[model samples]
Target chain A: MAVNKRETIAKNIARYFHDGDFVNLGVGIPTLSANYIPEGTEIILHAESGFAGQDGAITPPWDVNDREACDRELNNPKWADKENGWKIGHKDICDASGNLAILSKGASCFDSVVSFMMARGGHLDATVLGGLQVDEEGNLANWMVPGKNIPGMGGAMDLVSGAKKVIVAMEHNAKDGAPKVLKKCVFPLTAINCVSVLVTDICIIEFIDGKMTVVAMAPGMTKEELQKRTEATIHFADKIDVMDIVEE
Target chain B: MNKVVDIRTAIDKIKSGDKVAVGGFGNVGGPMNLLYELEKHPEINHLTTISEDFQMSETPYNQGFTGLLLNGQIDEIVVSFFGHKKAQAKVDAGEVKLTLIPQGTLAERLRAAGAGLGGFYTPTGVGTVVEEGKETKVINGKKYLLELPLKANVALVKAYKADRMGNAVFAYTAQNFNTAMATAADIVILECEKLVENGEIVPDQVQLPGVFVDYVVHCEEVHY
Candidate 1:
């Protein structure tokens, strides 16, 4: 059976994380890895937007009453509720600015700190981020597309370079059937020589000894087909196995 | 001096062709009330905005600078992440210019300006496009790029609470770029959800001192 590319990539990437790992999941496919974390392993997930230590997924039962109460306080200065009433057992739900508001429905509670300190201090054990293209030398070019009006390079550069290990989770090929795993990245690079592993829809490629080597492939996807899709030279591992992706 | 003012008066501090630094990561902690007020003043054009993230999340919370960008108020943006499709369309259409900086470097630059430093050296973007025209120095067998401090004519910040004296406290992740932007601008405007009397907040609770604040406005709702 053919496996979903995003699920396969996310599942394979989750295997690299261990217990007590300070993992940063970038937006997109990497964020999906949270759903595939093994049952017993404890991973402290950090979001650069300012929350850390949340469980895999941000489930809901969010404190709606607390949000309304905070909203009331905002308009009425005479409302003397100094303390934010939105408390889910020591967890405070505030508006995005941290004001006492209804807890955001899909978010989990986390410790707050200066996000830059976490990024620059190199506190992350691993970062799973998406990539537009990853070169043979492990350089990442996920921020910009050449000649295209690219939005600003968000936290990808910091996360890619600051994390102890960088795992790129992306589709094996672009929508037009071009290889994203390339010999040389044609797009503007986010960071140089930073990517450690590549988890794509079709195969798991690792940059080892300065070469792009295929360590595993998706079920029924042959090495020959992966080679045809790739633009760079490829090598295969001796004990390649079908990727195991847990279904939700 | 007490710096608290209404949003209309706060918008008056911004002029045409001004460089403004805003605090927030996406919609979180953004000075939405101030930006909305500024948006109404169409004469305030050619604004060069400095921020961490430029794109809105396509949610209702997407109200701040994205609104300004959509209205064609922003001329250029110096940001770390520019992923909003709506804003990207503007850039693609040549309505806006973009300069991308590494996220860590952008934060440190703002911090350096607030701290009164000339410039600092960082290892980020040493050999990439970020290093193209910047000065580079090798110290201790390591390459570092000399990044200048980024200051602004006006800064709009979002805080959870503020005392009448303008001292502010930030909530959770909403404090992203606010504390740094607060001190790096000539005129600092704070949008707070709650206002307290002077001396009500403990010194330790103050994330930004009143000395850096020039204006404070009570903002009941800021989209995040």
Candidate 2:
């Protein structure tokens, strides 16, 4: 069995979604969970940019055939010249990353104030986010990388504080081969003891009573292999199940 | 009252060291025409901007705050998302001072200023670096950080349409920070894509009331 890390992680994460769940997917790998949502489940995706019921992201540089009209009217070379540049998808329909997104039929829009009100009011059920570092204490550190230019924490803190279940959907290791599932987070914390579950490339871990327990692992992967990639001492569930990766 | 004015006339209200709140997330809902006009004036320096995002670099047209940042027009930024690598370089080089606030906290702070509230306690940054140096109180056994209101000297807002009476209507999700920032500032200058007569926009359709608006400028929407 071929182990496609991101697809397997996304597929496994999708199993947690219940019907009629209002979920917020953060930028990066968490956004991929939208595509792998379990069949027959109705999940309303929330965009912090004042949109709820987001369907999916529009492919970049939305195809425009009228080059001359685009040039004369929009004056955006990206819109005019299709091959070289990117088109601004829609004026108002965008995800948190400023990429254009399509909305569901019953989607609603509001101002920034009302949007965060929903987030901070505990109206959301589940929030899946990308993480830089996650500790055994269920603390997540994802917003800022130390010594780099600080990109301000957008909405992670508020979501973590408000959401009933916070899921960290990311790769198990960083680009430098360091374990992101760490003994303790060296980076600044986005929130303390806020993460409920973690779906990584190699395993699905859940925080049960403040303990890191591996509930599932990727196909052909052993506990020793998973532990070798993880920095924290992990406990295993009684009957560990293989991650469900629906192949195309 | 006839609040409609030219773009330059509206842009002239911003002075040096003014606390300016701008609307927009990235390229959407930004007061581009007004900012474009402000970018021409090099004298409007040492300004503090309160916004949701940096209005990162867009292609074709150099719209949003990048022009102002490049010209050293902005000194301090109280924002939620300091976006773009180039904008971050400016911050790392000590060109602008950044006060990063969580997105919801930033929104609520502006709402507090607009609603005449003193401050709010939020559980967002309770155990994080964001709560450091701030007062913390335990309510119902939950720790919450005390975040204060943030008011601006001038607010530059964008609307899809506006009437002569200054009633503004926003389109779709374009009303991001524009609606909130409009209420939190002393002077609110609104730029609209279409300017109409007094009775053009219906009473119920108006997103921003005329009472809070000071000036209205008719400017075409710049396609990002």
Candidate 3:
């Protein structure tokens, strides 16, 4: 079976997770990494919006009678269902016990400043972020497009620059077939020399000693094929390995 | 000091052209009731808002700070992420002025203001557009940009619980910028979901002490 690029990239990035690692996942493809986190390995996921443990859909326990009130209060139709207690969509949610927790399963929260302090002070072990463009020097440009109305950079700059290891989880090519891995980024940069690993649908690229090295490629893809799709100069390692695709 | 006050009375403290630093990452820690009340006061205009981001979504009730921005109560917004489509359109049409600061810098600048510091240097935006027209100094061999402290006339913050004395605690990720904004403003108004006795909250769990809070308002419902 053919693997989806995003899931492939997310699974590839998930391999980097270990027990007790503090990881921050960026909005898009990187968020998927949380679902593929290896079992028995406890990794803490950090959201820039000030969450530390979990991400994605959270279902809070609610009395059947309180469903409408929850719906009316949360302003989300997802919570309007009478059968399923309450289903509100939030970046983070708390429990009835008054602890800052994620209902996605379980998680903890802290003051927002403490979260950013961990992000800016290099306390995070690794951060998985989607990128618009990554250069040979490991520079990233994922925040803004010149002259566009895209929301400004939130925590990408701090996460990329402060995390011990920065991983780029993105598709190999743009929708228009342009390579996102470029010789030079036309988009405005989020941070300079921050990316340590580039995980794409087709291949995995690593920056070792300031050089872009191809460490693994997707099944049925060749180094030449990935090189054709990438605009940056791609150098292969002494031995190339097939990327491990974990089936969910 | 007794810091708990009625929401209507707290809203009256804001004046026209006041620089208001609001706490929130979108609607997470946003003081929506205070912002909503401030919107009704048409006399309050030309305000400058400092925050981490604009509204997270376009939901009418969850508008939060974006409600003030849409009502033209805010003339300038200093934030890290300014990408709300409606607000961005206003910025493009020259309706609102935006000053984009990196998220961490935004947090640190507010923190510096509360800590009573002049400014601090950071290497986050050295060669990017963020460095334009900013003071750059090299300490050792690395270049750093001097980011001044951000202060405001009034700050609106949201917390999960507040005691009678105004010592506060915040909910999960909802505590985003509230604690920092609480100390960076001249008058800090906290909107809380739960109100307790002065000593009801344990000392260790108190995120922002009463010294920094000026007013505490009990919000009946969770706005965000």
Candidate 4:
């Protein structure tokens, strides 16, 4: 069975995430991956706003009645959520005598000190980032598009430098059809040899010894077919096989 | 007695019937040492505690509100997000009385109370049902206000560093409502991790001056 490029990319990512992993989903494509995350495994998502141990939908239907569903349970917990979530809301009300205490579940949030400490201290198991250019040496060029506009580096530097596993999700081609996976990135680099795996629409690219290695390709896409689309040098694994996307 | 005293003697100052305001937002700027000390002494009881989140590890609301509940110390708790299933379950079951406030309003109210203004107007809980029976007035005939005062009996603050004279500098979230709250309280207690020499803080960096301070509980380490 032949699978398309995007579908194959999603499966490869899902394969890496196991149950109970504390995954920080960055804003764009990384954030959408949560929908595809396998349930019952509890990949707790952390948002910057200040919710802790939260996994339910962001805001329930706006009706006053539906407001009660604000803190519904989702599976698993992030590293920070496990310790101080109770501190995120009213503790006394939670222990009130007659009323049932509803624990406010915020699957997304960050403690100012602890949140940054964890990111800086290598507590996050994995962080998925987007990239403007990913060079052969696994150098990540993200924060800016080289002199477009600098809107302060928002946690990208910390996530890039600190996360144990840095997974990147991006388009295989630029707007001009130029390949984003490059031999040498022209933009300012965020971190060197940081990206662990590249999940693109076309194939799975891994940074091996300062070069691009294609571990897996789309089902219908052949070796020659994959290289043609990419403008840069792409290393093809000798025993490369089609990804098991459809089966999953 | 309207006075600010040293925290080493804060236990003596904090009575059973005091409503204390703690500083911190989502556990960022809390005075954990003072609270921890208050817990350990077990000298005082029946406290009406106020603040954003009571983040004790054991029970979601364990160390806190329970002290208020079992002893009947807390008559009422004003907070937001207390309705998060676990805490709301307790509220609905009749164990405690929870007066829910919107998040931003809670902080501003604390600030207002600290600043000594009787009440400030806010458009937060207006019109859509949050404004239930509270006196809603029109300002400049524009239909723009609800006035709620900031009130607290005692304030507990945590800081990164403090001078022997009592100036404090906060870490990330600033959670300085506990600081503003200090102005409103008869008693102000500080649990500091680092106590520097007097005149250590430059005028620019000093957040809360010694004039508002009464007691200092010198300590090392935070409750992480």
Query: Which candidate has the highest TM-score of all?
Result: 2
Q: What is the DockQ of each candidate?
A: 0.39, 0.75, 0.50, 0.02
Against the correct fold, how does model 4 do in TM-score?
Answer: 0.47
Comparison by lDDT, 2 against 3, better one: 2
Off by over 4 Å in 4: A1-248, B1-8, B41-43, B59-72, B83-90, B138-142, B174-176
Candidate 1 clashes between residue pairs 3 or more apart in a chain or in different chains = A67-A102, A151-B82, A152-B81, A152-B82, A153-B80, A153-B81, A154-B81
Q: Over the stretch A13-119, how does candidate 3's per-residue lDDT look in tens digits?
A: 98889898998877678877877777798887777666666533322334322536555545544443444432333433532111222333345566656777888
- As a whole number from 0 to 100, the lDDT of residue B183 in candidate 4 is 64
State chain A's TM-score for model 1. 0.77
Per lDDT, the best of the predicted structures is 2
lDDT string for model 2 (B28-136, tens) is 7888888888889989999999999887564434368878888999999888887678777877888888889999999999999999999999999988999999999
What are the Cα lDDT values of the candidates?
A: 0.75, 0.84, 0.78, 0.58
- Chain B alone, TM-score, model 3: 0.95
Q: Largest DockQ belongs to which candidate?
A: 2
Question: What tens digits encode model 3's per-residue C-alpha lDDT throughout B99-184?
Answer: 88888888888899999999998877766778888999999987788989999899999888999788998766778788888888
lDDT of 2 by residue, A1-248 (tens): 55677777777888889999998988867877777877788889888998887765422334333334434533455333455323333556667777655556577889999999888788999999988899999999999898876788998899899988999988899889989999999999999999999998888999987899999987788999999999999999999989876554
Look at candidate 3 and tell me the lDDT of residue A54. 59
Q: Which stretches of candidate 2 lie over 4 Å from their true place?
A: A57-89, A246-248, B58-62
C-alpha TM-scores of all predictions: 0.83, 0.92, 0.88, 0.47
True contacts kept of each: 0.42, 0.83, 0.53, 0.00
